[model samples]
Target: MIAPAQGGLRVTAVDSLAAGEGIVPGLPIADARALLPYLAVREADPCADAEALARLAGWCGRYSPLVALDGADGLLLDITGCAHLFGGEDILLADLTRRLTGFGLTLRAALADTPAAAWAWAHAGPGGVLPVGVARQALAPLPVAALRLPDGMAAALGRLGLRRIGDLMDLPRAPLTARFGDAVARRLDLVLGRASEPIAPLHQPAPFRRQLAFAEPIGTRGDIDRALEHLLDGLLVDLDQAGQGLRRCEFSVFTVDGGVQRIGIGTARPSRERRHVLRLFAERLEEIDPGFGIEVMTLEAPVAEILPAQQAALEGGPATGEAELARLVDRLQQRLGRHAVVRLEPVDSHIPERAVTLVPALAPPSHRPWMVEQPRPLRLLPSPELIEVTAMVPDDPPLTFRWRTVLHRVAQTEGPERLSPEWWRDRPGTRLRDYYWVEDLEGRRYWLYREGAYGEPRAPRWYMHGLF
Candidate 1:
C-alpha cells in the first residue's frame, strides 16, 4: 500500500503521513510499523491490478497499435513506423505525454535502436528519442542499473568504479566479456545500440487501422466524406514510410445508433498515391448509406504487401493503362472479398511436368527469378499416370497402347525418355520412372509413362497422364 498510495501522491509533496516511510517493497509489515508508528494501509488486490494492467494495454492502441506492458508499471511501444503523426519525434513525445496524463498516467517514453536502450532512457535519463543512430551517446550518462544487470554483476561493476554506461563503454571488449561473462556485455551492447533488440508488441499483427471519434454524430455526405479523408491521410503516411502498399483497404463508419457503413477498395498493383487511392475508394464511399449519424470512421489495411517498383512502358513503345483492369478487379474483389482476384508465380521442380504451381499474387516471388538449363513444361499435368507398352525395344514408345479406354495406334513413335526419380531425397526408397512421348493416329499428342520397371517378364501397366 505504501507504493500504491504513493502512486499519484509523491513522497515530498504529500502531507498524509502513513507509517512505513523508511520501509521498502520487500520489507515486512511489522518492520514497517516499527519504522513508523502510524501506517495508513490497505489490503493489496492482485485481481484488480491484473485487470487494470490489461485495460491499460488495450487503451494504448489509440497511440500505437504496437504496445506491450514491460512490467507492472511500465509499457513498451514500438514507435518505429508510428511516429510523425503528432508532427515530429519531439512533438510526438509531447503529445504522448499529454495523452497519458489525460488518462491519469505518469509516463516515461524513450526511442532508441534497441528496447534496452529505450528502456534505460525512459527510466534513467530524459524520456525522449535518442536521435537516430546515436543511442550510445545519449545512453552514456545513465547508471549501470539501467542496463538491467544482475545484482552480482552490478556490484562487481560498482566496485570497479564503473557506475555509469560511459564507464562500461570505455572498457576493452575482451576484458569486459572475460570478467563479467557474455550476459553483461550483451546487455551493454543492447542498451548502447550496438546489438539489435526488437520489441514484441502486446497484440498480434493488426494491419494499419485508423479511427476518428467525432464530437457529434455526422449524417451528412459532406461530413462523412471529410472524415474519410482524414483517416486516409494518416494510413498513407505509414504505408509510404514502410515502402508497402495495401492490396486491400477498408473504411468502416460506426454510427451512434449501432449502425455500420463499410466501404472497401483494392488495387491491381501496389500504390502510395493519396489522391489515386482516395479516388479508387470513392466509388464505395458513394454507395455508403448514412442511415444514422456516424460517430466514428476507421480505415484499415487487412491485406498488405511490399510494393515493388514497376515499369509502365518499354523503351521503344507506349504501354497499356491499368485503369480498366483496376476498376474491374476492384469491383469484383470488393463484392466477392479478397479471394476473388488471383495471380500466379512459377515454382521449380525436378519432374518435367511438376515444374509449376498456382500461388497467390501477394506472395513474394521465388528468390531465383531465372533458371536457364532446365526446360519448364509449357503446361502442367495434375498427376502423371503410367502407360502399357508392347514395343520390343527397351527405350521405344509402344506401337499400340490403351489410353482413357481408347486403344490408339501409334502412327509415329518417339524414343522412351527414361527419367529417374531424384535419389537425394532417399536412396533406399527411390524408384526409377521411365517416361515416353507418343503421337497417335489423330493429331492429338499425349504423355504416358511406366513406373518401377521397363520390362523383364512382367507386362507394364499404362496411363494417359497429360496432353500437349
Candidate 2:
C-alpha cells in the first residue's frame, strides 16, 4: 500500500496473489482490506523500481544497443537491423520472452516500424510481430487509451462514446482537433505512423564494431590472440576507409558457458595503427579466462575521431618522438592502471589550491591557458598547513616563522598579493587572504598567506600554502 494523498492509503500496486483475489491498484486500502481481512502490505518504493528498470534496460543491450524505457513498466528496443542476427523477429522475441520469464517477470513484446505503434500494440494487441505498413489497420480496434493520452482526456473521450481508436480514425481531423485539442490528433497520428516517433536509447550505440562467431569453441591462448588480430585487422580497414581512428577499443569474448569477458584499452590520441592497438591488447590478453572455451569474439571502438592521412616526413622529427612517447605512456598505463599516470592541468581560478588540477595522462589538454604573471610555487600542498609567524605587521610578510617546529629566518620577501574569495560562489563568512612569497635563510622559498584582516577580534591565522 502507498499513501499518494494525505488522508488516505491506496493500493498503488498488487502482486499476482492479491490481484487474483480482485485486489487492484488505485483501490482504497479500506475497501481492499474489507475484501481480504488477511492481507500482506508493504510501502511502495518507486526509486528502487526505477533503478531495477534501468538495470533491466542495460541487460537488454545484448539484444539491441538501442534500448529505451517506456514508462516504468516497459522497454522499447529498436531491432531494425539486429533481429536478423538472432535468426528472425519471431525467434528473437521468443528468446527474449523465454529468458525474462525464467527470471520471474511477466512481459508483453510488440514490434512495428514505429515506436509509438509498437508501444500501443504491446499494451492492447496480442504480443507478436506487426509487419510494416499496417499500423493503422492493426491499431484500429485498440482502446483510445492506447494512444497514451492524459487520464482526464481519455476519460472525456470515453464519455463521448469515442472509446475505440477506429471510431476516431474515420472522423474528420479538424473536428477532433477542435473538440479535444491538438494532443488528440498528434497522439493519433503518432500511433497511426503518420508522425515520426523516435526512441532515445539509454546508451549511445558504438559506430564501429566487428564480431566473429566460431562453429567450434576455441580455448587456447593462441586461438584468442589470432582472433583478436583478425578483429583488429578488419576494424582498422573500416576505420581507414572512413577516415577516422580509434581513441578507445574494447575486446569482448563470449564464452560457451554464457559468460562474457571483456578487456579495454585507450590511446593518447586517435590512431588507426593496427600494430599499436594489437600490442596494447596483447599485454592484457592472458588475463581473460576462456571459461569452458569461447564461442564468439567482438571488437568495438566506442570512441573514435577524425584522423586525416599524414604525409611522411623526409626525416625523423618531433612527431615521431611524440608518437613514441604516447605509445610508452599507453603501455605504462596498461600495466600500472589509468590513475597512476597523470598530468597537471591549470584551472581558471584565483585560489592557489584551485589554480591547477591533476588529470589522467590520456585526457585532453586544458583549454584554459596557464597564468604566468604571478610567480607560483613549483609544488603546492594538498591543503594549507597552519604555522606561527612573527612579522612587522599582521598584513605584512613574515620576518620569521615556525613550520613543522623548525624556525626559519626570512632572507628575502617578494609580495603580499591580496586574494579574495569569489563572492558569486555564495560562500558565507569567508574573508579575504593576503599571500606572500618569502625566502628563508637557507634559500628555500615558501608561499604563505594570512586569512582575515589585521587587528580584528579574531586574530588572523597564517598558513604555509606551497613550496618553491
Estimate the TM-score of every prediction. 0.47, 0.76
Report clash pairs, candidate 2: none
Off by over 4 Å in 1: 2-20, 129-134, 206-298, 303-468
How far is 313's C-alpha from truth in model 1 (Å)?
26
Model 1 over residues 400-452: C-alpha lDDT tens digits? 88755678788775545666776665477455656566688996677676666
**Which pairs clash in model 1?**
19-38, 19-39, 386-462, 386-463, 387-462, 387-463, 388-462
Q: Using TM-score as the measure, which candidate wins?
A: 2
Q: Give Cα-based local distance difference scores for all models.
A: 0.68, 0.85
- Tell how far residue 32 is off in model 2, in angstroms: 1.9
In candidate 2, stretches whose alpha carbon ends up further than 4 angstroms from where it belongs are 1-7, 211-231, 250-264, 278-299, 310-319, 332-378, 389-401, 407-462, 465-468
Model 1 vs truth, CA RMSD? 11.8
Candidate 2 TM-score versus the reference: 0.76
lDDT: worst 10-residue window of model 1: 6-15
